[model samples]
Target: MFIKECAGYELEKEKSNTSEDFFNRSVVTFIDGSEEKTLHVLYVRYFDEFIQEFTPYQQDPILTKDNIQVTFKDIVALVCLIKNPGLRNRKRLYINSKPEFTSYFQDIDFDKLTDVVLSVKQNNKFELRSPLDYIIQTR
Candidate 1:
């Protein structure tokens, strides 16, 4: 499945704020080749904190929404290095190292999401590659 759309907004903060207060709320929608959809609401934060707690074997942290909690893993995908020429590029270190866990989707224009090429997760690795390469590799 590829990302069909991604939209987000910053959360409000009070005068007295902590590190946790700095985050954005995003909703990502995925569509498979057969047109099935999956939606995920993400609370986006700094990558440093997320990476510190990340481990492949451990269960991901639970997400709380409307008083309900759910545990889920972030989507792991490959983004085309050449798409979205108008948007600012992400840092090289963040491009291929980890999954799209923390800052990958931060501050991006949701409308331009469809202008870029995206690959669905077929495995646990992420890399900077052309969309065609991703499809060939997965096949």
Candidate 2:
């Protein structure tokens, strides 16, 4: 399936005093068709039950007509496998891995996601499908 469009991001921070130290983000690329399928740049920061615990803390405040688009955390596990150039060129994750790298999604811009999609596809652990892939509902 072709990933027609994509987006995913996080605008959060810990209890910090000043905003300078706070974390910010930049957009990534949207889609591609180089070799293997390419998933967006969505990833997880933790493993184990920590994921379950870390979730409820996400922003859910319903204010000023905003959205709470969440990006699942497994995509990080998939990234860890793409560090090496050889593996990346091969388009597959062939090393010890975790189960969390199974499913995830988000609503980020193309800039912040393109590199990730390229890297992930380079390692071959993701499935880049078009939004229609789900909307169409094929068996």
What TM-score quantifies how close candidate 1 is to the native fold?
Answer: 0.28
What tens-digit string does per-residue lDDT give for candidate 2 at 1-139?
2222223344365556544222212122222446433333323322322434423223322011123232333223222222221222332232212343322222222233433444443443334343332222335
The whole-model C-alpha lDDT of candidate 2 against the native structure comes to 0.31
Query: Candidate 1 — which residues are off by over 4 angstroms?
Result: 13-21, 41-44, 47-139
Cα lDDT tens digits, model 1, 18-128, are 543555444334444445343433343453246335422233333333443222223222122222221222322113233545344333332222223222222212232
Q: Clash pairs of candidate 1?
A: none
Query: Which candidate leads in TM-score?
Result: 1
Per-candidate clashes, comma-separated: 0, 16
TM-score each candidate: 0.28, 0.23
Q: Tell me the whole-model lDDT of each prediction, alpha carbons only.
A: 0.34, 0.31
Candidate 2 backbone clash number: 16
- Give candidate 2 regions above 4 Å deviation: 1-46, 51-68, 94-139
